[model samples]
Target chain A: MTRSLTTVESRLRKQKPDSGQIPFGRTFTDHMFVMDYEESKGWHEPRIVPYEPLTLDPAAMIFHYGQTVFEGLKAYRTDDGRVLLFRPEKNFERLNLSSERLSIPPIDEEEVMDYLKKLIDLERDWVPEFEGTSLYIRPFIIATEPSLAVAPSKMYKFMIILSPVGPYFSGGIRPVTINVEEEFTRAVKGGTGMAKTAGNYSSGYQAQEKASKEGNADVLWLDGVEKRYIEEVGSMNIFFKIDGEIVTPALSGSILRGITRTSILELLKEWGWTVNERRISIEELYQYYEEGKLEEAFGAGTAAVISPVGEFNWLGKKMVVNNHEIGPVAQKLYDTVTGIQRGRKEDDYGWTVEI
Target chain B: MTRSLTTVESRLRKQKPDSGQIPFGRTFTDHMFVMDYEESKGWHEPRIVPYEPLTLDPAAMIFHYGQTVFEGLKAYRTDDGRVLLFRPEKNFERLNLSSERLSIPPIDEEEVMDYLKKLIDLERDWVPEFEGTSLYIRPFIIATEPSLAVAPSKMYKFMIILSPVGPYFSGGIRPVTINVEEEFTRAVKGGTGMAKTAGNYSSGYQAQEKASKEGNADVLWLDGVEKRYIEEVGSMNIFFKIDGEIVTPALSGSILRGITRTSILELLKEWGWTVNERRISIEELYQYYEEGKLEEAFGAGTAAVISPVGEFNWLGKKMVVNNHEIGPVAQKLYDTVTGIQRGRKEDDYGWTVEI
Candidate 1:
């Protein structure tokens, strides 16, 4: 943590994309934050260097055994011409949690946070200022050992990269139909389901593709055990409103503890709304809908603050909610979360930090 | 499949490792097989080049989403100086199976096997001729698209690397102790456990470390749903001999279809042994041990041809098998498989291809 940071600026800078044309994760900034870890030296020689490709041995452990962890958060550009980061420390802390589950060696989260801030400050101009546009930050660690051993690697490389991203929904927010996935299992207990590791993301693609082919926007994954209880949807934590009560699945070992989910819970508690965090089965959800009690359903995650669910397809049964319209609760939560992120709403808690 | 293979010989030929001193997965050969896949041209430009590091974009999908698959096989140098590959085509077939599960674009298995034969022929000198030594072949495919999207990568790179591996049991073939892991799950029915993908290996390291700390050689993972049915042990498929019969966990969607496991079943069938491939629960295994019906237990995989299980610890209960020594069945299987691999025993099946 005491190592002096080094900086190497790029000689030629890339032209920033036009305001409205910015894509998600396709374009990068000028520089990136990098650090290497060895068993003897630990994490050392933190540097901010020009964005470039990574050169690694073909037998690097990451290429064979996927011993890697990643974290995602965004840097917002406020209307007042100031740059802000929303809960960056939480991302670093979660990254460490992910590393532990994958058997990766521990990293000092505080020092990495400091290094991330320095890199963001140096690339301040890359923070898109257009409405709903921000710089997406990806901090990841890959095993760098040039060996094909099945065990954890002794060497690692930690890096933080910036990507200018446009809005999640370029058009107005709309509700999406989600099929209750009964065939594929995303995560199970005592697995890497809760960790923000690499494997968890791509494993869900086949299910996602199936739902897309069936005219559904995403797949609402059920619990891996009995395939009855609700877990998550796509890459987000899910919530539902029934009979004026807001409910979300509890933090099961197989469910990811989303930062956006945490923020929404805090907001809901402050608003004094009736909320419950417990197991909810798909049968019960449908029963409630038949009884005219089901109100709204939405997903919460970093990618989309609140992805409203319009319909649920369980087996061949189709159940519609909110008349296929975005509910008021989903709209308010999205606005409040995005508002706080962009520094437009009052920062009651220490959520957004200015650089 | 008719594309002619190209070769680029290495100018700086590195010295091969000393016999009997070779480590597992380290000390690569001078050249390797490489190919690229793009949406436009498909898998093209199959060439063999010097073994070197891979230069990839930082935003490569493999670093973010873990979309990759790999296979492991070995080439043995017969006593007559002929390099023979044992069932190399099966490895390529399984690699495609793994690629399907990970959503990676598939490659023509026949074409890849042809390219691998050429690479191994060129690196023939690197094959260790010491007793119990062989050339390890690792064929891996990585998602190479330089984007952070959570989907199947459009660009990919498939490469085959070679390493000279020493004998698995360099000292002598000794029985290993394994633990029945109750707290961790290796694979569930609907996950990537059936696929030899990158993520499945590292995710089990924590359990492996726990077992190692408890003075056990590896972990015996159970099914994820109930954590009762036997799944796998470390990275190998497990088999148990009970009441004069051999049994292994059925390939019920979560268990890997190991090549060694397949060959053992064929050999057992030819020998007219009573072999059952069905779901085997931990409770039944312990009960059989209590009744003195448990005879022999061993792990089947590529690294260790026949890893005998002398002891098993299941929730604090220790059950010693075959009096802490390799069983007769395990020894016979090992000698038979390795004998055929080394061209010592007659191979009735067309399992080995000589170059």
Candidate 2:
């Protein structure tokens, strides 16, 4: 699958950031993967070119129609200097799912994955050696056709860029406050919620901005229909520990099907814990809090393996959890996931791919 | 804004398409208006430059977060060699509203309008003189900052481009068939539905493509909450003349506030016709059809002044209207609106602005 890709080395490599404290998505590596798709040629001319700016026609459909999809994953450097990727296949599979929903032509996920591995192998030194630092991989496809029609684009561009990111939390995993979003909807039942397309992300920026202004980290998104059941927290799928069991919102068409959420569920199942993927409304959660049955809550995603929730302020009413500190369950899940990702623990599930 | 602009004309102008029959969004004028925004300095550097490709980082927020807004309008060339724009302020005003929702910086409507007139003034010859042919104007703002953070971008780009379009109906205005979309939602309450943003447009491509494959011109989008009440027809506002009353869906927060739809309502009111801007469900519309009182239906937008709806296929059940032909009311409205635009008739409402 990597045979069709041509490689072009950069004349000058960028100065790698200090291995001490790196930031997210601000700096890039020396090279990137690029591909083009046309109605006549399909997807062709795969290449690894120098990291540079993209030249696009002023009327490209991506700037007008928001026809784009993306995926996020990371590559870690273990203590023994081995590079590993966690469930890279899942991200590309979801990327194709997103492209399909946006009416963009599908890609060969396996072939693209092979090309991605080859690119990463060439830049193996870019993966940071810090305990919490890793090289972040961003793969996105954008509609590049120069047209103003309200239909699907006849041309597209697929790209992959690498950036080194620090730990999401500067110090350690700390519980943060969230605003319960009731006035704004994240997605609708028949909308692009289930897909990882760009449209599903920034539409909730207003609510998140308002929440952040109120001294909260993010907002707890509710269902689009009744605005009752919980959908997600910020950009991650959410889970609650209540009634001595784990409960999370089911994949209700309008909720993102997160890869991290699936991994967490599998981990819990292997440990023989009770987990229910069903609708859990804000009202029911409040009731559980009143009865002292609501234990703790956290968000799950690729960026942050487990983000513990400290408090929820719903319309000015507060529900404090675990006395505003990280709970035992969240701590355990974080340690286990990060341990496996960094090769500090045994690879029991064969989830890591080494380069 | 016009005073801040600098001009650079193209040295080699491409031959213009022949005037026999033009297409939509395929050809452009020689120059375009470009502006930029940054946190340190607000929107600046307004210039009319040669129409060329834009150079941007591959990580531009527009491709990742979909934070972009746009508007559509037309410039008409009258028989007297004068160029006129139909209610240009309305489009700019809507563009600002869209910017507010998308969290992008807003531009001065009056100032930008002045700049737009200058751009169109320089390209006056590009506005075709045929009856239905006009210069289609597209004003858009995209997030240009090269970042991957999930928040409002700190930098932006604002530009306006012009394209020459022939009559929407190449021959006579033909009625179109619409599919009632019950499985996919275009927008939802508390969403970006009212904003003329990119995300709200292309997210409906899947449904629109499905409808087109079924031999329908477009889909009849319903309310995102209940999927019952009528919302829109593809990219336009839909109206139904039922039981001697003209009723269109209200500006429910989940529906687009179309400029042409507003003009049509204003004309109907001036003509002393019964009009209702409230929710009208598919069930009630079907009931009206069953009672033989569904007088006519049409879609209102900038590209197509009036797109008559002759058939509706809802879940395999069909309802034919107006004997599958354009109705008298649609024809009259189109004539009066376009007449005022081209200065063929009196500008009774002062809707036309001559350049």
Candidate 3:
């Protein structure tokens, strides 16, 4: 699919925010990438244009049916001014998987990667120079057909937008508290849990908000069917270490296959650490904690890389892990991952792409 | 809170589609209702505006998080030029319930009803007079906050768009064939199943599309937990007649509380019919079929008030209901409801609201 690229630069540039005050997703770059899809022409007219508001018919299917999917990744700036992206192809691959599940048409992954690289190169100046700050890239597709029929959309708009964001954890590395969700379930087996679609996130607002109000940083969801086994936490994949082994929930058709989770697993295996991917029930975890075998727990995602879980509130009982401090395993994983991301360590895995 | 109304009429009116060719949600009225909500200031600046495209930032929370909810109803034009709405308040009440589940601010039901009435009266000419045609009204709210965080939006836009639509069943009142879904559960017991939000619909598209490809009109979703008990069919609540009694699935925190379903149950109980709302498993229903006790089956929703089930395919075995004909109960319910809506029958239930 050979396509010509068009550029429309912004005439008036907005002032950049201070690095110290940079917030997540509150600021945008000057340019954005867009492409349209029709049943007849397929994806066409790929272009980079000035970032602006999208004009859509009030009856667009996306607003009513929520037929949309999105991906999030960041571009880091090295101390010497080179920009690096950590496993961006994985994000687009997941996006296509989500599109398949939602019945949206697929895009050319190779071509889109080329276009994404061009987009990042064009917006390279927006990449923050601070150690922890980076340019966040959001690639999403929305159903734009103006109809009320409950079916797959005939028209779609795929876009890539850039936002300069501060560190996910502003105050530095800290262990957080999580509440075990017993009433609400995020996704079930044989559902859209594996897909990174908008519906999965929206359905979790109630549980997430409730947890926030109860003084917990996030909610740790259990399996939808039995409600005993651990699934994931908030928006990240969770891992638990018990009896000197790392255990994470296996892909059960209802858990998001986070890239960071996969990378962490690979790193642990390469280091000769015992890693297991299987169902770990809440009862079993509690029993392990009582026996002093549970040593560490953390969440893995693109946003925070690795967020340590210091405490968990299950029903009425509270269990503190590692005395409310970051465990050695969690700290090493975070440092190694972030070090590779910022180009401070050797890229032996060839995970970073320089543009 | 009191909200002042403003009007902006379209300079040029769109040509109305032929009554016979009017497709569902394809054609719109000249004006629409709009309101905005902020964290500090509640819903304010309620107004009627010309039908036009909406401009939103690329990073709006709705596009990424799918924090959207909507309602569907219609306005019928009687033979004597009078317009009637059937239990419009119920739709708003359900919308608030969905708002609460999605962490959105609730709208004043009474005040919003007044605004809806004014908007309907202003566009009264757009209401179709055809027997089976009416003006389809869609009220929706979307998160407008420009952020990529997974939390609920701090800003929202509530709007109502009117589309003149023909009957859902274009040919006639023929029964529809549905396939029993063996995979892909729609919602679970503690999920967002009761909310009429966008995620629920989008997540079911895969199952619906697969059913359509298998020569079925829709998919009959079973319970998400065990996939044994019946839940719903496509977007409607389902009912079955076994041994001369009507049985529908009770609201078990997962099934939608459909207004039409409620009305049908009320009418049946008032007429001295045995109606039961309880769990009905697939195995039990099949057993009743084998004993020749299964008589009638139908689905109820706002679009198609009563859709008879002609046949059901479960794991390649087909069961034809009433020789693939519309059952007597379904026909009667459709007639009674449509007649009351069009003012041709007595308003014994006081459901019709004249505009």
Candidate 4:
């Protein structure tokens, strides 16, 4: 069943930031979408209200047990002023998967999509039309039940908020240096790695902080069991081009199935490129690098369509890929993905939807 | 530096629940302790305010990243009108340890202790005086910075709330049946397992739900890597009395450093009992059971104090322990620990703090 949207305008509208200098997730739109779930009633009272603080009991389960999940996507404003969303349905589908894994009651995907579109329509002005700017959407579910017990919460709150964000690379698309994480593991087999849950992100903070302190851009996590297999880059799916072939880690249940990563794979296959998804151990990668077969390395996610990896430091040995610069493959993939997202390229895959 | 406490009384105090019918964490006291932390100001404005809903931005990091930690302890009201706190310092110490791991700022132990005592004194009437009832204390820290970036938060809120809880075993210490979790592993080395963080608890919800559906009290987690070595239980530390010796999992980086687990080990040592803190595999446990050397099994935690395990079902095979009854060691340990906590027995270890 569809729920009608309720709107409450804010008395004081926040000043819009300059599209050229907009930082990620710091500024929000005037309104947000909210819905509540209870044991007796399903998700109800869908509404778009003025952006404000949420009042919760101190004993809320989200603060203690962390029964929470979230999804990230963006609304793009084309040069011709049409607002488009890139595979928004995929986000909601993943949100449902996360909810089930966390023992939370799932919401109606179509109904939530309607609510999301309504929210974006109301805040359409917040979408930026700059070349590298867009309106980032964050949808999350949290356990709101006021209990300290270690069990599934009986109450939940699902919300969506919008923030104007500038380009990930302000100057240019510069390759980044990564450190191989040997001490800290993000997720193991049969863990919550595949689910876009809060715990999976928090578990990587230590390693990320350590890598940042060591002058690295981010950490490249290894498998939890053997610490040999390459899992993923920090918050993004990783890809390597070795011997003129593109390879990415398979969905081993411990790596997030990124939407951008999926699109990249589809695009690669369409371009008649050899692409493989399987276990890629660190030793194998080093061997390829030693043989000068490792041509390019990059990370893919919604935030940065493609972030090239220039250097990798594993256990004190440094290996530079593609002479510490972006390779042809990474550049082409970036251009193709961004072109389709911004309506500059043909929508052969029908991945973007006009709202 | 110590901060002065400010008090704001509630206009409408809630009706106190009957101690005999108290449910864990469902009901809270009239007041709560609150403190705020900023990167520049550190922790400030320590106060005891009326228990009310906390207002937070919907994009708070705790909701999306799970950057939160919590500690559980209790305040017991002795028969002679004295409130006793068992090893409260230990909880705060562990809280600091958790903070370090999660990249959150640490709080002053002495100052927070002072704040906790003030809070308990204000709500001392809420402490249950029944034989198996006590005022449960939950102190937690959550990232409050309204940012969507996957990084440590700059703002935080530390809170302590009180809940009157009845005995964990309301049916007079009946042994519980446990299911050995093989498919869903809990935590692995180099993970956030040793810390009292929210992610660790949330990650176990799936396994716990599966066990509950299959008619079990809780799931007994194994090491995340091999899934063979025994780890902690759902919310407690597992212990076994096999071949006349007490055994528990060593402090592998993936198991929590439980406060109750420490006390139990100390008591066992003081009583001249053999206690081994090392890896104990499921195969070794089953071997002991087959040889009739498995004497008892129990779980240790703040809430339960001590809970005996009647049976363990591993891979469709069920093994009964101590003839499905509490062994002498488990009984004695429970009585001794509870005695020390409630001030019924002599406090030789200075574990109790008076407020």
The digit string of per-residue lDDT tens for model 2 on B183-226 reads: 99999999989988888878899899889899999899999988
- Report how far off residue A171 is in candidate 1 (Å): 2.1
What order do you get sorting by DockQ, best first? 1, 2, 3, 4
lDDT of 3 by residue, B164-251 (tens): 9888898757899999999899999788899999988978888988898999999999999999999999989999888889999999
lDDT of 3 by residue, A1-355 (tens): 5488787888978777667458788899999999999999999999999999999999999999989999999999988899999999999999999999999999998889889999999889899888678899999999999999888899999999999988889876789999999999999987888999998997888898888889999999999999999999997999998999999999899999999999999999998899999998998999998999889999999888999999999998888999999998899999999999989889999999998
Q: Please, what are the lDDT tens digits per residue for candidate 2 over residues A64-147?
A: 999999999999889999999999999989998888889989989988999899889988989998768899999999999999
Predicted structure 2, TM vs. truth: 0.99
Per-residue error for B163 in candidate 2, Å, reads 0.6
Candidate 4 positional error at B206, Å: 1.5
* Candidate 4: tens digits of C-alpha lDDT, residues B1-355: 5687899988888888765678889999999999999999999999999999999999999999999888999999887889999999999999999888898999999999999998999898898888889999999999999998889999999999999999887865778999999988778888888889887887788888889989999989999998899999898999999898999999998888889999999999999999999999999999999999999999999989999999999999999998899989889999999999888999999999999
Q: Any residue pairs clashing in model 4, and if so which?
A: none
TM-score of predicted structure 4, chain A: 0.98
Candidate 1 chain B, run of 10 with poorest lDDT: B17-26
- Report the error of model 3 at residue B332, Å: 1.1
Once fitted onto the true fold, the runs of candidate 1 whose alpha carbons sit more than 4 angstroms away are none
| Best model number under DockQ | 1
